[model samples]
Target: MLLKGKTAIVTGASRGIGKAIALGLAREGAQVVLAARSAVSREGGLEGSIQETAASVEALGGQALPVQCDVTQEESVQAMVQAALAAFGTVDILVNNAGVAFFYPITETPLKRWETVLRVNLTGAFLCARAVLPAMIARKKGSIINISSLAADERDAGTVPTGVAYGVAKAGLDRFTYGLAVEVGQFNIAVNGLKPKEPVDTEGMRFWTKPEERQGWVSADKMVKCALFLAAQDASGVTGTVSTDEELSLWHGL
Candidate 1:
């Protein structure tokens, strides 16, 4: 139980990589606060929902608090963080896994679409991190993991029809991780980024990628394990690094 007695707040935790990370933290003895926009409705392409994830966490002998939060909204993010603190005494970990992508050519990309993607993918992460940083600094012990994508490193010309917004936002997230890490290292707060080569198999992935072609993609469980390793003490000296599932498994023997 590497995270025994810890409390973790995982955004977009209803399913996919987020759900996997929440469950992984719970397995390590952390009380997980699962945050998502809506847990029950089938709208917005969200799969399984936060309530479902929370139930699974409880089934594993861990406590769970399902919180409704639209990460793009500052008030919603603040409420979610406050709710987590109310449910649990403090937050020891924050996983910024909530994101959105707009797959389109730059010329055809609508301003609203670009803004939505940026708000959810980058600004949302910023809001959540800002809301949690003060507490984490006060405790002087915390881990913040931002979920990014490999597309951030690749050139858009050769890849699928993904607009500049998604790529630029993810790249910004990576820079955010580095800047936050440097600023908070003295407070014993670790901030790092995780990038997946391909989409994990989830309802969201099915909608975003070719379902049959997702076999070669990294498993959500594998990513979750990597996230746990990052959240552990073994990564005490590691910060500002963007890691992958393969690299993490090799380094942590997962």
Candidate 2:
């Protein structure tokens, strides 16, 4: 119950790592706000929904609020934050897990596709962080974890397919995490970036990649310990860095 009596907001929580993190926090006695754009399965076969994630949380005897949010839109982000505050009183943690990835070369990438990738992966994080900061600063305590990816340094990731725009956006997110951490540290709010050490076997990844290519991929649930550790941090503790799950696990001795 590391997070007992705490309230957390997890975006992109319809499925995959986001949903896994939501349940993990709930099991640790934290009330969770599950935010996602998808209320139901879409035509492209994207599965899971915030409603389903909330149901799972309640089944564990935890409090849950399901909100349909489009993080790329500022209004939607602000509304989601207000709903979380109204339901749980205040937010103790925020996991910015909403993202999109494109896996093609710059030459083949359309201008619209590149814009979309950057908007969701980068701008969406900015909007969500801005939406939550006022409350977190007022409380003088909070944790903000930006879910990053190895694509931030795509040059070294020879084993994984990388897209020019996706890499650029994640690289920007890394900077955002560090900058936000510095700005909010004075208010006792910890901000940091987290990425999978290995490719995650998420629903989206499974749909996007060939089955034979997922050999060394890890399950999304393996993220719990590190996420829990970061969620408990502040300026006096770890902050202002981008860490891989493996590194955090070793440092936390989880």
Candidate 3:
């Protein structure tokens, strides 16, 4: 059990990569907190609600908690962190996986759209990190993982740059991860970024990418496996790096 007896808070865990990460962490024996804007439902993109995720954890002999949080709001994030502490005593890991993407030409992109993307993807991450730092520093141990995208690296060929706001936000997130890692290394908190290839097979992936391109990307499970490894106590010394699912899997022989 890589995460036996630990507590993890995963944002955007209602579905897709976030949901996968939540389950993976729980499977590794961590007490997972499924934090999102709302409860998951059968009709929604998530496989189940936070309750369902928690149920799955209990079935696996682990513990789970469902938390409603709007990562963009400081008060909401603070409240979510408090709830996690109240439930599990402390948070040992934090996953910033909640994000939004938008497609538009730079010339025509609206300010509101850009701001919305930044708020959810970048600012939200910052708020969550801030909310968790005090507890983590007090314990002198923690891990923070930020989910990034390939768009931060390359624009799709001949496609009108699908994620201008997303890309900018993730780029900022990557830098934020690096900066946070440096600032908190002395406190034994590891911060890193994980970037998935384009055309990933997540629900959000399908919504963001074209059908023709879907088969070209990686699976959510692959990324979740990497997240699980990073959340382990064995990964304590690993920090300030960005990893791809394929890269991490090959390195770990998974």
Candidate 4:
């Protein structure tokens, strides 16, 4: 019950890591606002929706609000936050988990694809953080966790595969976390980036990896404990840095 009485907004909450975190928050007593690109399951790819996530949250006896949000669009992000505020009074946590990736080579990648990566992975976090900061500052208590990746570091070059935009976007996101944490500390707002220590068995990862080969990948649920710790943070506690799941887990003794 670490998050009792809190209201959290989780973007990209239709499935995978986002969905897992949303449910984890709800279990901890937060009324979660599930934000995703679609209300219903998309026709292709992985099959889950904000509606499904909302249903699960409510099933766990927590209040839920499902919002269709295009994180890349300012208006959409604004509307989503307003919906949360209208329903819950205040936002106590924000999880920037929405993202997109293009794995082809830079030479083969289209301009639109490159822009899309930046918009969703980097700019989307920027927009959502901007939208929620006013409320957090007013309360002088809030946590903003950016779901980042190992690709942010140059040592993880293999993670880039054939493309580069995804890594570039994540790196920018890390910098954003650091800078924002420093700026918002005066208001007691905590901002930090969290990432999986190993490959996660998310829908996208399962698609890219062979079934047998996926045994080593961690489950998306493994992130919840780390996320839970971050969700409880403020300027006085951990903030301003990017941490792996292992780091936060050990730090919190989970």
Candidate 5:
């Protein structure tokens, strides 16, 4: 039980990577808060919900709280954190895994779509991190894992299927991980970014990728395991890094 007696908040926990991480933490004995825009799965996506995830956690013998959060809204994010604190006392881990992406050429991409991606992917992480830092700093221990993308590092021109906003936001997230890690290191809080070395077979990925392209994708379990590795580490053990699943697994011998 690597995370026994700990409490964790996982954003966008209705489905995909976020849901997997929530369940994984619970299996390791961490009480979990599942936060997302809805308690039920949205139309036209895979089946999942905050309530469902919470139930899964409870079934694993861990406490669970389901919180409705629109990460793009600071008020919503704050309310979600308050709800978590009311239920769990203090947060030991925060997984900033809520995100959105739409693939389009710059000229073809709508401004609203571009802005929405940035708001959810980058600004949301900022708000959640701010909300948890006070308690974590006071406790002198915490782990923040920012979900990032390999698209942030891809430089081959005109090859990427993802929109510019997605890449830019993830790159910004990586920078945030680095800067925040340095700032909070003195308080013994660890911050880092983690992304799949290969794409995960997530609902979002299914929608965005070609059917044939999905064949080589990794399972959601891989993301969950990688997140566990990050969450279980102490500040001295890991911080201020942006790494892929493969990189982390090799480094930690997972």
Candidate 6:
């Protein structure tokens, strides 16, 4: 078990890549804190829920704590962090996987929608990182994985862009990952940004694109593997990286 005796706090863990990462960590003997806004997939995006995810983690013989968290709110993030600490003693890992994407041109995008995307994707990461750093620094060891996206770059002809706001937000997150890594490296915390090389076949992706358009999409398992690799890194290794799934697989020889 690469993560034996570790405790991880995963945001947006109710479904999709976040849920898969939480399950994968649990299977590797990590206690997991499942944080998300909904207990279930009440918003009609995916199938899993915080309750269901926690139960699955326990079924894998790992501890699990389900907390309803709105990462966009600072108090909510702080409370979630406290809940994790209360449940598992301390957090050894934090996966900033909570995010929202809007796929529209700037001309059609509403100011509120753009702001919402940035708030959830960028500011939320900052809040969660801030909330977890004290515990991690005190322990002098930890990992922070920021879930970035290929959408950080402008898309080409074969793909659709994830909107200007999402791209900008993820770009900001990547910068945050690097800057945070530098600042926290002295405390033995590894911070890195991970982007999917290919689109994962997530429910949200399915809702956005047609079946035929996503024929070559990767499975959530690949992302889980990549996340596991990052989370398992020692404090002295692989900090301040912005890597893709394929890149991580190659580097870690997965």
Residue range 133-212, candidate 4, lDDT tens digits: 99999999999999998877855446325258888999999999999999999999999999998787777666655676
Q: lDDT per residue, candidate 6, 1-254, as tens digits?
A: 99999999999998889989999999999999999998876754567789988888888888899999999999999999999998888999999999888888899999999999999999999999999999999999999999998888766633755688899999999999989999999999999899888888886787778777887788888789989988986469989999998998898898
In order, what lDDT does every prediction score?
0.85, 0.90, 0.82, 0.90, 0.89, 0.90
- Over 1-254, each residue of candidate 2 has an lDDT whose tens digit, in order, gives 89999999999999999999999999999999999999776777788999999999999999899999999888999999999999888999999998888888789999999999998889999998898889899999999999988888867645667887988999999999999998999999999999998888888787768878889988876577789889989888999989999988888787
For 127-182, candidate 1 gives per-residue lDDT tens digits of: 99999988888888899999998777877453344567988899999999989889
Positional deviation of residue 113's Cα in model 3 after best superposition, in angstroms: 1.4
Candidate 5 segments exceeding 4 Å error: 157-160
29-65 per-residue lDDT for model 3 (tens digits): 8889998876757564534467766677688787889
For candidate 4, what is the lDDT? 0.90
Please write out the lDDT profile of model 5 over residues 1-254, one tens digit for every residue.
99999999999999889989999999999999999987987777667889988888888788899999999999999999999888889999999999998788899888899999999999999999999999999999999999999988887543337688899999999999999999999989989899988778777777777776666677887778889989986589799999998898898888
Q: Residue 132 of model 6: what lDDT?
A: 94
Q: State the displacement of the C-alpha of residue 175, model 2, in Å, after optimal TM-score superposition.
A: 0.4
Candidate 2: residue 184 lDDT (0-100): 91
Q: How far is candidate 4 from the true structure (C-alpha RMSD, Å)?
A: 1.5
Model 3 clashing residue pairs (backbone): none
Candidate 1 vs candidate 3: the TM-score winner is: 1
Q: Distance from true position, residue 141, model 4, in Å?
A: 0.9
Alpha-carbon shift of residue 58 in model 2 (angstroms)? 1.1
